[model samples]
Target: MLQIESTFDVQGDFGDSGLGKLLDMFRDMSDHDEDPGRFVVEKVIEKIPAPLRWAAEPFEAVLGAEVNDQLDALVPGAGDEIQAIAGALSDRARKFAIRSVLDVGLDAKGRKTGTHRIETIIQVFKEARLELPATELGDKLAPATRIPITLGAGEFEISEHRLKFPAGTMLSRALPRLVIPGVLGKVIESAALIARWFACADTAAKVAEKLDDPRAGAIAMTACASASKSISDQIEERLAKIDEEGRLRLEGSADEEGEGTYPAGGWRGAFRIDKEVEASIDPQRNTFSTQEQMATQ
Candidate 1:
């Protein structure tokens, strides 16, 4: 299984009280269309103290406006106040950001369903900002427990558990058909290779500048040589197979003279009867066969 982990702190004055409110609000809103007021309520809930919830209600009303202004200042042409609120919440509360785990599973039809595990630690800091007490924010995240969550086409269950302090709590779920492991690995490998290529190129340029030698560029150039050759060989091999298939199709045609003739060259002399034979024969049968094989595999 592939695991992705990210950490962020929540910002603003509300703290854990605010975070809990926001999570509850989000859980409720997830089923409906976007609402800026609901989003603001969530953010405000993260910043204020529990005892101050009554005092914070009024501020929550203006949250949509405040969040909009912040977003407009940061991103031009950014519309949709609710979306802006969500984005700002994500940015300001990096510390409060939920750590989500998505478990991917595959079905017989090759479709993917994802189960999600979301968790975060809510901490209360001293007034001096020197130290704080950490606690699991909402629900405990457990490894094996599956919650009743409905993902698009696939059905999945999620279970959450709280962990002992000093040990971060974990929320995990079993998701079905989120993605094929093989495809995901290939994407990750491709991205890593691209990043490596760029790093090698940058290093080569730096070395060239320091050495003042034209040959220094070859250091980075050499790293890419093998990758380029591998890609080229794969393309050439595919093309060769395609060409052979085309030739075989042409050979199978009933008219001997018509076979292997260019479509543009007419059937007589420069327009020979054979040359005029249409080469636009549909390859749907072969294409469909190939597709079926791939799907089965």
Candidate 2:
């Protein structure tokens, strides 16, 4: 009897076919029409606002139309009025945002959602100037002894008395899916659903305050609560639909009996594919790097 063992490292190359498939898949996942990241980015970009615009908002909350007129810039009562309203909405906005975020919806276990909502609030506070109080969260923020904590972004001061407050809008604007990278792609997908909710409460507050009706605040609160629930439900549904579509990308529809494997469908409709893989591990590069490159070559 003779025993023989044979082994060969074929290291087959995909030539052009594999590269073509990969490119097709990449294109499919990135297509604005089909991509959740694109969907979310566009939506988020709409809400992020410009940095200068963001900076102006707090001032508006403080001064309203008082700051509107150039001539009124030095009005006798201007500083007093600004001081009155500057921190007025900060606490209220924080409360409204925190409440709205907690309403994101429940998980499968019938428990409340994760900390993303709180984190969003924290991020908003950190990046933007809010009237700092002696409270715990307030203490975490960069102090603004005067008004404008930053004159403008990257230096270039405007006025000595204007305060040097900076804005987080630039950061918000920076997150849109102009290019769409890894897990951030997943975040972008949920941006529209979550982002608007972040500010809707603040908006409702602003509108109520502007109306100057004693009952308007209560009325808006009720209406906003109702509306927020509906929006949360909508977001939950949209995420579910995306997950179903994304499933096809991650591991293909399971067998009818849910046993055997089927052909892969790459990451077509999936935006959160990274969620399935470990952090620092990109599913695209791992799957297509060596094998697909060799085949494409």
Query: Whose TM-score is greatest here?
Result: 2
Model 2, span 1-297: residue lDDT tens: 101111111111112222222223223323432232232222322333354234323333332232223212334432232222222212222121111011112346543221111112212322344322223333232232221111122221111221111112211232342212343244344433233322334544553465555554454444445554554464344334322322111111111111111112111122121134211112332111011110110
Best by lDDT: 1
Write the residue-wise lDDT of candidate 1 on 1-297 in tens digits.
222232223233322332323323323423333343334334333433343434444444444345344434544323243343234333332222223344434445545433334344332211112122123323332332222222222212222222111111110010011112433323223422122112335434443444465664464345334443443354334323322221101111111122221111111101011112212222222110000111111
lDDT of 2: 0.26
Model 1 ranges with Cα > 4 A deviation: 1-38, 79-297
List where candidate 2 sits over 4 angstroms from the true fold. 1-205, 247-297
lDDT of each: 0.29, 0.26
Residue-pair clashes per prediction, in order, are 43, 13
Write down the TM-score of every candidate: 0.20, 0.22
**TM-score attained by model 1:** 0.20
